[model samples]
Target: MKHIIERAQIYQALKAGIKKTGVVLPGDVKRALHQAIEKETGPAGKVLRFIAENLESAERENMPMCQDTGMVVAFVEMGDKVEIKDAFIDDIIHDAIADAYEEGYFRKSVVEDPLNGRKNTGNNLPAVIHHELKKGSDLKISLMLKGFGSENCSRLAMFKPTAGRDEVIESIAKIVVEAGGSPCPPTILGIGIGGTMDYAAKLSKKALIRELDDSHPDPYYAQLEDDILKRVNELGIGGGGLGGDITTLAVKVEKFPTHIAGLPVAVTVNCWADRKTIVELKGKDN
Candidate 1:
């Protein structure tokens, strides 16, 4: 078992990572955005120029990339042989979130209930955490600070086995066109393509934690991602919703084997300020 600091440290790391969102653009994403900006012939280029400049300033000053710090979602891959020492992983994670919010001076956005109670959680406790056991010795934790702007617009569809690739394409295209710019255009789409309905949704959300520029390991899936990216950008919902040639930066899809009768699909979107990071824990400290 590893004896790394408590989940508090993990929480602090997440908070720190989230704060960098729009500010510290991933190198590849930044490059792509720059290229798109340069090649544009209209106002989208201007908007992108301003965005790039804003990003530079945000990163240099170490400020929250976007005013909305976002709700924390964690994806933990634990090793079968690795164990967390002296703490229930869940409690450690919660306490870490509490401590991170306190130390980072972040906005307290989560509340007690969705409707009736409407009270603040005060410390963003009980973060959305998903755990999995894989064949490794080190624990890998990935965090994505998801904002409702884009998340609110995502959708899931369960189709009969007859629903083909064309239908999936249509659904995604309609979603992007309907979203317009609310989720902040030039979005990265996460698509979950199989499994049960709920599990598909989970996979969709999990996809958002991946690096924007990556593809699923399978080549056929990678082509699907490329196709989706092409179709989404064709929507013309340019940066911040402006009319432009590039509306989506990428499409990431993850899939799972499902019941023979079901074809489940889910889409989760990340705004321009995609914030995420991966960290690993050594023996005795996960």
Candidate 2:
């Protein structure tokens, strides 16, 4: 039996999710920040504490955590047995974002054009959407609000198949070190390994939405994450890049099989704000 989803349902879910994400930091992220405070000292520790206080104030006042409300990236998983009745998914998403940004008083950061015109889109439309079809009667929307500070620090490297784990680690660490305080220290790193160049980049962005406490299902990758996290922190970038023991809060990696001759790695840097949320909508059938 096909289960139908109403346009209004999706719009409400997306709008509420966006508003909530903008104001509230995820539990895992809040915990991570608190934990870092215990491990770091000096100016870095002070900065992390200040950040924690800021989060509390934002939630208390119902204001955005960061001024850069960010460009929206939505990953939609639609079950084969589910169907939308009244409107296109993209249209609903755009409407939801427009309403959410305006209603929530989140900053409108998106522009209409990249180079020539550079006109403000005003409502933060045209979110980057990725869709997947699965075999259930529900839709899952995972949204990430990516700010330009960390987004600008993103890097991709196409390495030779001969590149070993150390080489990959060095490359990623170098990128972060070079980034210094620019991407905002104590950031979370979402790493994509293998696959083609573009797919790797997408995977990196997807990895950012994972909870900081979540471990990779694969043991090998989980160890890799630990190793990378250790190496990054050792670089001494610290909180707010003032220099300390905790440069990054966590490292999450996602891997896909790739061509025999190439190993593509992409790193998506997310600042401490790391705004993301997932909304699941079930159709009217069990």
Candidate 3:
């Protein structure tokens, strides 16, 4: 039986996602921040305290956690057995974003053109959407609001297949070191390895949505993540780059198959806000 989803459900989901993610830091993120605060000292500790206070205020006041509401990126998983009733998914999502941004008074950061004109899109329409068809009868939507401050600091590199693990580690660590506090320290690092250039980049962005508390299922990758995280924190960049122990809140890595001769890696940095929201919808009982 085909599961039918209503247009209203999609609209509500998009709007709620924006509101939820924009204002409140995720539970895991908050916990990490608190842990950082306890472990930090000196100016970095003070800076972290201020960040925590600001986040609490934002959540209490129901205001955006950051002034730059960011570019919308939606990942949608649609079940093959489901059909929407009288609604186009993309259209509905964009319209909901327009309404939510307007109603919630969120910043419209998307530009109509990237290079030349640089005109603002005004309503933050045309979200970058990624869709996948799955086997079930439910739909899952994950939204990420990416601020350019961190996005601009992202890096991608293509290594020869024969490059050793040390090469990969040093390469990515160098990116974090050079970035300093620019991408906003206490940032979450998303590392993507073993895909084509573009896919590596995509995987890096996708990795950002994963919770900080979750560990990679594979022990090798888990150890790699831990090693990289330790190296980054040891850089002594500290909170907000003033210098200290907690430069990165967490490091998440995702990998994919690549050409035998090419190993591509991408690093995406996400600031302390790390806004991610998810919604799942199921068909009504027949």
Candidate 4:
């Protein structure tokens, strides 16, 4: 049975999701912050507490948690058996983002042109959207509000295929240390390994959307995540980059097949805020 979704349904769901993402921190992230607070002491612990309070205030007051509400990045998983009515998916997403930003009073951060114009798009249109087809009939949208502080710290490197595991861990740790407090300490890292350059980058960002508590299914990668995370925290970047025990909350890694001669790695960093939300829409038939 084919399930149908109308344009209005998509728009409404996305709009509400965006607004909520801008204001509310994810539960996993909140839990991590609390845990970090307990693990840290002195100034570092104080900083984590302050961050927690700010999040609470934002949620209670229904205001954006950060002034930089961030650019929208949506990952859409559409079912193969689903049918859409009345609009292109891209147009629906753009309309929904525009309305959400405007009505929610979220900051407009997108520029119309990169070089010549540098003009604000005003409504944050043209969100970064990645689409995939799945077997089910439901539409699942994962939205991330990517603030520039951390986004600016993103890094990619093409390592030789011969590079060993220790080298890869060292390379990633160096990036985080060099990033210092700029991406905001207690950061979350999304790592993409293998694949071509661009796809690796995309995978890194995609990894960021995963829940912090979720471990990689593969034991090898899960251990790698733990090792990288341990190395980062050892740097003592701490909360707000003010020097503490917890430099990063978690590390998420995603991998894809790549050419035999190349080993591409990309890292996408998200600040402690880690603003994101998931919206699942079932078809009318369901």
Model 4 C-alpha lDDT per residue in residues 108-203, reported as the tens digit of each score: 999999899799988987899999999989999888999999999999999999999999999988998889989877899999998999999999
Candidate 2 TM-score, true structure as reference: 0.98
Best by lDDT: 2
Clashing pairs in 2: none
Total backbone collisions for each predicted model: 8, 0, 1, 0
By lDDT, rank the candidates, best first.
2, 4, 3, 1
Root-mean-square deviation of each candidate, in angstroms?
2.5, 1.1, 1.1, 1.3
lDDT of 1 at 239: 87
Q: Give Cα distance to truth, residue 10, candidate 3, Å.
A: 1.8
Clashes of 1: 8
Better of 1 and 4 by TM-score: 4
Off by over 4 Å in 3: none
lDDT of 3 by residue, 44-127 (tens): 998899999999899899888889898988889999888898788999889988988888889999988889999998998779
lDDT of each: 0.77, 0.93, 0.89, 0.91
Question: Candidate 2 lDDT, tens digit per residue, 1-286?
Answer: 9898899889999999999999999999989999999989657998898999999999999999999889999999999999888689989999999999999999999888899789998998879999999999989999999999989999999999999999999999999998899987789999999899999999999999899999999999999999999999998889989999999999999999999999999999989988999989999863
Give the TM-score of each candidate.
0.91, 0.98, 0.97, 0.97
Pairs clashing in candidate 3?
238-244
